[model samples]
Target: MTLTLRQPSMLTGMDIPSATQPTPEPAIHVRGLEKSYKDLRVLRGVDLDVARGSIVALLGSNGAGKTTMVRILATLLRADAGTARVNSLDVATRAADVRASISLTGQFAAVDEILTGRENLVLIARLRHLKDPGGIADDLLARFSLTEAGGRRVGTYSGGMRRRLDIAMSLIGNPPVVFLDEPTTGLDPQARLEVWQAVRELAAGGTTVLLTTQYLDEAEQLADRIAILHEGRIVVDGTLGELRRLLPPATVEYVEKQPTLEDVFLTLVGAGTEQGQR
Candidate 1:
């Protein structure tokens, strides 16, 4: 149970250790969840399970329906067919219960521009009917390292700072399942790392996480199990090493000392594929 220090500059990604086997008692589960708009069926019989206290990553190509799935699970949208449950509460039928047990941080940060960091959290706490609104705000600021700048308006904060505050506010009620839909999408390198760190800490604190990201490295670093969605269905699901074993890590192989992977033709690769690991 010894702890070690991590060099900040070394890497900036959420690293959920790969699980040895499929987890049990998933915090969130979906069965044949399907969604459609007009003629386009975005989600087709999508099934996924995220175990309690573990981080599950959804890796997929563009238009693969990752975000749509997240929306359904978050109760932001209803499914055309099938069912989704958070902590065993149906997202469609028991939305109030489901929402109370889960928090969703969409791709964009949702902080109020007029409110300061502390005020933003305090506002959310009040809405959640939490006791000691002042204490909750202080704890969130301190936990997210915003105590120093918390007094400044959220609009004055940096992109990373605003994102941190948004995430902290999401936890005002300490929900068990948190869905982060591309949480680091628009962040710069450093800001992305900060969000990743917050996610790692959340998982370590025993919160079940279901995250969707276009960044494969992010999933590799933070996901206990990785699921690849293709054409609205799960094409592959396993640990990093398992998926790597399923297919060549990348299309181009090393020519001993060939050109860098940068210029290599990447026609279509999983968002998490890396070079030199084939």
Candidate 2:
């Protein structure tokens, strides 16, 4: 929240030429990823590939390893075994380089309340060693629609505004990939839409984004691809249309009056038992 690079940033390394031949590799590549605490295994041989210029949403119920996966990708935690690459940079050994290419916004708006919105962005820009700190701050503020509130302390901001500032702070260095963990957790309906719009714009600009959330509707709205995680493992991964095809079509209630309980169940449960919440 203070934007101090709290520990040494795991994100520093070589910059490949833009004109270099593009590999078939994805922006994120995870193979046999495992994490254990004593005898309790939280992640078990998880594997995934996220393409560049896309948004991949991780969906799951409570107790799933979604947050754990996010932490590892963000370089906040180490896997007991397995490999992860961010922009082809290894998450463990090339941590600094990997971090450099990735930006992460955690579930909560972890802003420094004492700092002004402009100060928050400047802090991150400085921590990332970007030139022209003031200019960088100004640019992020304007881009996130926080320009008018730039000078105000984050503590004075509404939930939506604070989240915007928090996300803006993460982008000061213009990382190519971003990991957002349950970004809409605490926002009101309107604030959620604003964040969704921001996420869409980020992906539209060719930034690879990985988002983890419990909200199915959010995933359907924003993810170019969706992967369902359950009990620390990825259960399914594919495009929304693919999943929908595999799943029974959901029934709709188009109406003038309140639907009956049976109608609600039928609409929500769909025709197949396989179509589920997680």
For this target, which candidate reaches the highest lDDT against the unseen true structure? 2
Estimate TM-scores for all models. 0.81, 0.83
Question: Cα deviation in Å at residue 222, candidate 1?
Answer: 0.9
Q: lDDT by residue for model 1 over 1-278, one digit each (tens)?
A: 11112211111213332354354446788889889988999888988878777898999877889989998898899899998878878899989878877888988898899988888988888887877878888877877778888888888887888888889887777777789988888876656777888898888766788999889999998999999888888878888889889875667656677664633433233333121121
For model 1, the stretches where C-alpha displacement exceeds 4 angstroms are: 1-24, 248-278
* CA RMSD of each candidate after superposition: 9.3, 9.6
After superposing candidate 2, which stretches have Cα over 4 Å from the reference?
Answer: 1-22, 249-278
Q: Model 2, 189: alpha-carbon shift in Å?
A: 0.7
Candidate 1 has an lDDT of 0.78
